[model samples]
Target: MARVEELLGDELLEAIRGRAAGYDEANSFCHEDLAELQAAGYLKMFVPAEWGGSGYRLQDASRAQLRLATAAPATALAVNMHLVWTGVARVLQARGDQSLEFVLREAGQGEIFGFGVSEAGNDQMLLDSRTVAAPQEGGGYSFTGTKVFTSLSPAWTRLGVFGRDDTGAGPQLVWAFINRQAPGYTIKDDWDTLGMRASQSCTTVLEGVAADPDRVFRKLPVGPNPDALIFGIFATFEVLLASVYAGIGQRAVELAVDAAQRRMSLKTGRSYAQDPDIRRHVAGAALAMDGLYPQLESIARDVDDLADHGSFWFAKLAGVKIRATETARQVVELALRTAGGSAYFRGSELERLYRDVLAGLYHPSDDESAHATIATAWLGPPED
Candidate 1:
């Protein structure tokens, strides 16, 4: 299996970086970057080799995402949505569930999958859904609800969505996939944001859109449970999300180093790199990044190896996300301070990174949710 770095060469990254600013300025999707990545077969990184993909393990895929993010955080983030679904399929496959095998096969056939699970104000994070899934005449369901932050909106061929089905024995959460051309579904062009502008993560409105019987993959009771599907989604989503932020921090540190070296001090007749304070700031950011790298890689590897962490898995996954996001924020702040006023410019990479990292706080398992999850795991559930 070829390494991800090898697959995405330096030339490709430079090309992606060259176009990132233009896309951000226009607040559009990274079409050119996606085309290059698609040509390189990046979307199929997690698919099995027999399916004509590189068959990269989760750890390797996360590393590739980190590298990609360093060049263009928005591009990496947009692409991460596709990776999340494919990563979820890989996770399910490892656990002996072939329910999502078609996802892999579809990728091999040039299908692009987009995540459509995030609903506006639905903070329960997959435990609940604002969308309604009404049963059809024969089988399958018609989902009716709006999903926010639908990345790859302009290019996705398939969208993975979930909703509530009250017609069941109880209100069960229905998970399914719908084609982009499915009836009664619309992709709203309302993705203008503070950061990650190039992602084009617009709003997805589903109004009685039908999901084929074969496409309705899972139906489980609401709230926290031990379902493999839930675990797969949580684990893959958190890990990949963290990798992107970590990559942003990594880029910030690199920029900081470069700035410190080139910035000369008139009073001392030397560069900022020779100053103890500047050195300390860069070292601090590097230290924080060093801490996250191991956790990201280790947890991803554990998922790849299917190591059983039981109930602890959720806490660990959430922990890595929180750590990576918070650490990246701090690193970016330090980088900004180290780089001085120049980094505050609109076109500065650090300026973009600062905004991109903030998006991490809005992902599933936010700091508050993650802390509650950890506290509950360590001390049992709160009093009812």
Candidate 2:
């Protein structure tokens, strides 16, 4: 924690926060923030130390991400995409799988990775893909499809994409990494949105983009199964996403506290903080956050320690994400109420947080998916 604080000091966070509003207003990518983070080697935090990285464990990385999100949620969210790949590699390495070693090497070499697995209306999550993976003569595949919400689109050098490879006897899912310089790929600057504008998660159009055999990492059955790659992706993505939202909730509570302490009530002729109602609101937010912090940390620690949860791991990961996100949403709402009408302004941090929190609802393992997963885990899969 001290190392993380030293790396991302107050001066740097102030600088990042100073530029956050401007970037969000313009709906632009946080290029300067990214450059600063890259210079500090923050981008390679998960890469193994032997590969010239900090090699922090999953728990430490989650803490670092939480702190980063407190200053700039959009920047932290964009960086999450890059961390996801490196974290996946680390997860596999811990499991004695060297399949994603190249990811660590490339990330240490300053190559940013982005996730391109999401597709519009494809709510099956990783279970299926709308993209077509046309097999080539020498074992490579050309993908033709569009991937949505591709954060770090403008900056990533490598993108992890998946598509259906039906050339075999049965329909197989192909997961691979594709170079950004590859032909037939276009990054659209169509990221105008309600919030988290600095993320610049634009739509990526792939028209026969080629991924060499070396980059094609996994070929697994379509539906949910016990694949290490799948587990790594699910565990890392959900936990980190939860961490980001939890930070937002933390910041909201702090803001509410500050507002309450400073606000004056003419009727009572005293500070709002002295009022029971204001204190109760702040306490409620604090209690909600208190419950979330332990869960987020415990789950992340379990991943780092490689605690055996067997088939229950998926449910645990999904539960953490769902809980953290919903809790953050509730906390932010309370903060806005505590802050009064001032928080309703367009440029207000609380307003931005309110909109940013909405994004969590749309991420993987959403409420619907999470509930179903938990139910299935507790009471077997539903009969056909």
Candidate 3:
């Protein structure tokens, strides 16, 4: 069989490059387009075969996401979150101790799974969530709390929420696949943000909702069984997120090069593309992008190795997240500056790319945690 990258390369690239502008205009992807993604079988790449999915590998999944992000950051950001969540959900479902098959099928079928993990004044951890999951009569629980910055909430069929059990131990994750047509959950529709505006990230409220125990992926104090297996899973997710931003950066450079080729400097009566300054800027941007490719390739290779050998996965995961995070930021910024003030305008592709690339910094790594993880790993055992 062809490698996953070989399978998804051209198609993923075409999808992103073709639809990026429309996604920007819509400020989020429409349901019909999302359904098309499902129909294309792209939505179920991470889903297991038993769930009527291709059971594709994670590396293939990462390459596909990277391709999508390159076309439209918001679409990539919103959909990538669902893809990673689906991957994680499949792992939990495999336990059979926590059967989330019904919802998994929905997610596999391209149902939006808006992440409701970020909370006010709380770091992005399950324990920090204010959403409460209380025991209900019979066997379910009632959930009440607000989540902020959820991507694609306006179009989501379900939301994957993490909160604490009022009486139980540790953190509890609940998959609340509420009806978007219902009033049980309200989308604030107030996600006016500085970056990734097309993501349609909005606040969410879940009230008086009944959740079955079986729907709960795993209780807090989760055993090492799934957690250990999931470490590599999350590592791959980080790679996917960063890769999308890198694609955005790549698009930024492309836009700048295209513009430079057409622009002329009045003073010298020469195409801007021929000017030494423009050449230097574009060269630098390409170099940065080139640097990203090898690193991304290495990350894909390393992740595959970890899955095969299961060693040093956590540390390597942190390193790739950090590298992709910083490089994407630099590459996009270079593209913006190279394009000059015109790139700041609404019509400028670089403007959208600028906003989209910034989203990577706020992803799981966030510099601080990524650095800490690397530092802690480096300082292991205090050197004896």
Candidate 4:
């Protein structure tokens, strides 16, 4: 029920949008924006009201993120990792699972959570991991492996990490939280990229970093299975991720429309908005973006309502993420064309968005994986 505009306000978003270009130019983290958001209680948006949080639902959070991304995609993305964890905890609790209650409580207390799921060459995603989760003598586990794209690497106090424990029978996947201050882990300062630079999604190398007893959570068997935690994560992550890119697409179309209305045609001596070709291009981008909002809303609403779509859930989630991201890329390209050479300038917002939207392709459930997942959902598994 909470409105994002009230929580973020026009002034705050304007400041974030102003900083986005500078942060990208310097290849720095959105520390200032994070500070403001933390102060605004944005960090605890998903935490329960009883725990001193806003208690916003997944739909509210998704919509807020979509708006935030329009102002600053990288900041929205940097903060999204934290949102994902808190949202996951919220999802788990909504389903009557109290296992992640501490996550909600801590987030409410102002502790930031970071995403640590991505790894190099581990396309199995949640189903498998290359990180070694060796069980400790008394309890807990020591994780040893490299996790790439650890977003919010600098600001997060707790990082949700997972790994494969071969020491156990048949190799089980160990999910746990690693303290940022934990020993034997290195946060590499190597986040320079084409876009989304403010995220500071650096590489994290864990050399036997310890996860204390109680921190070691799920221990599911390798490969996909029916686990609520997995479902919760997939639902939250994909939806929020989609929302952020959808914001980018929306912003791009807005910029295109503005450019069309403001620029004049020398031959016709009229605004480009009156030009049929320009109007069609802007409309095409707007039309693509128009299709995304309902899909995102429906998906978020389903996650909130816990609608039992059964096996179709994964396909639907993956489809929306791919669609939102791919559509964003298309809309940005269209905007770049409509805005003409001015948009190609280094400091232009459209230019930055053009770069930022490309990062969507690298996220989980990539084109190949998503298409395969969708195909399997409808056509069954491939022939041997």
Candidate 5:
């Protein structure tokens, strides 16, 4: 697989560039394209082995994410969320007796999942969500909440939601693997965005929906100990976001290099590629991306290792997530600066890349809250 990337990098890049214009115009990915991805079995890597997924290591997953992101940001973004949810489900399946057999079977069969963690009220109340899950008469629980920015809203067959229990154990999660044809669920059909427009991250609402007892697994708060299963979900998201930004950076450089070869500045009577300043800027952007790539992978590897070991280090994980997100933002910004004017014009691939890349910084990586946690750890008197 590694050798494949090296051999076909240029071809893959070209295809991504070819689709970039149409993808931007549509402002969302085509279902046919996503269905093709599912058919290729690329979506099954992070799923549990029992479910027919490869269940690769974090390193492999991150690498795959980067490769895909480099080609098509929208596909990468949508698929990454599904991968994270799979990891979350895998952990619950492993630690607890609750069988994810049905959903896992579907996932292995190439069904996609939409995430349901980012609710409008729960965004702030996630740690203490009022979205409670009350026990049904016989089994399962009824769930009600307003979730927003549901990535892959139109494409998924399941939803993994986080909420607190009436028991007051921090937060609990439930997987509502609803058949999309089911009632009591609605897609807002409103995902207009300045960038990453193809993500189609619409708002989703679930009212009076009952999750099967077999489908829902509880992630109760166990004091300071990290919820390894849940942490992987957030950490996976952060890692993928970083990979997307890194890809955008590389794509920017590729665009600039292509432009330089074609268009010449009348003033200097030299191709933009021949300009020393343009060359230097592109080089710098490459260097930044190169430096950050391994760093991002390292963080993801640590998160995965921690999850596997059932360990917790809140501050450290937060720091890693924040660092990767912030670095991705810087990398993409520098890429845009390197590309200059051609990147700013309408219908320019570079401009779209810039917009998609900028979305990374603004996404809820919890930088501020993570920084506070890091400071709290540092300022606390030495632990015994």
Candidate 6:
């Protein structure tokens, strides 16, 4: 497997990093960054070599995302959406299910996949849906609902969307992909936010958007089930998302150390690095991060190796994402303090990271959902 540095490269990273703040300040999408990443074949990291890709695994891709986010969180995050789909296909295909092999093949051919699963006010993500999937002729389903936070909105060639189908015996969740040229949908330009602005994750309104028969993928029951496709999506999304924020935490630690080493104590005639209080603060953050890194790695490795956590899988995936994101937020706070007042400025990298890390709170499997999942696994479902 090719290492992330080799694919992303130092020069490419510096250029992308240089453009990050401009994208944020202008509240624009990272078009240049996306073009560069595509040119570098970053999208094909998980596709097999036979399909013109690097043939890497989840662990490798997670590390790549970490490194990418350290340089540019918003850019990395926007790109993360695409990687999630590819990674999901990789996960499912590796386990002997080729239902999504076309995803890999197309991604290998340079097509970008946008994630369109998220729906506003629908917390039972993946397990249920609010988007309506009305059955169409020839086994197709026309999805009609709004998809929020549609990352890679400006560049996706195929969008992976899901909805609920009532025509079935019971409510069945339908997962499908629609082409960007599909007529009935509209991509709204409404992504201005506190941070991660470069992502340009706009809202996509599906007015009976058409998902052709062949493009429609999984159609499982309305609630949780032991489907491999669901597992692939859940595992890939949690692990990769964790990697991005974990990168933020790791970078924050570095910045904290750098700020401490340079900050002078007016009364003591020494750097803050020599101050016990500052040292302890930084060390505490570092300890949290040290634990986080391995947790992320172990989970990614497990997904790659297909380690059977069985019922514990959801708990572990949820736990790692919760830990990586929450830890990153705390670490960024320490970095800001160490960087001293200057970091409060809008253009400061630490300031950017501080805002970027906040998005982690909104990702799927939120605290309530994640805790509920973990509790149910350990304590069994609560009595009716």
Which of 3 and 4 is ahead in TM-score?
4
Clashing pairs in 3: 16-71
Q: Between 4 and 5, whose lDDT is larger?
A: 4
- Evaluated against the true structure, the overall lDDT of model 1 is 0.92
- Give lDDT tens digits, candidate 4, residues 5-100: 888888999999999999999999999999999998898999878888889999999989999999999999999999999999999999999898
lDDT values, one for every candidate:
0.92, 0.92, 0.66, 0.93, 0.65, 0.93
For model 1, residues 1-384, the per-residue Cα lDDT tens digits are 888778889999999988888888889889999999999989999988899899988899899999999999999999999999999999999999999999999998889999999998888878999999999987889999999999999999999999999986789999999998888898898998999998899999998999999999999999987888999999999999999999999999999999999999999999999999999999999999999999999999999998988778899999999999999999999999899899999999888889889998898799899998898889988999
Model 4 TM-score? 0.99
Off by over 4 Å in 2: none
Whole-model alpha-carbon lDDT for candidate 3: 0.66
**lDDT per residue, candidate 6, 231-347, as tens digits?**
999999999999999999999999999999999999999999999989987998899999999899999999999899978999999999999899999999988888899999989
Clash pairs detected, candidate 6? none
Local accuracy of candidate 3 as per-residue lDDT tens digits, 117-153? 6777665443345677777666566678887878777
Give the TM-scores of the predictions, in the order they appear.
0.99, 0.98, 0.83, 0.99, 0.84, 0.98
Choose 4 or 6, whichever is better by lDDT. Answer: 4
Span of 10 residues, lowest total lDDT, candidate 3: 221-230
> On lDDT, who's better, 1 or 3?
1
**Candidate 1 lDDT for residue 264:** 91
Can you list the residue pairs that collide in candidate 1?
none
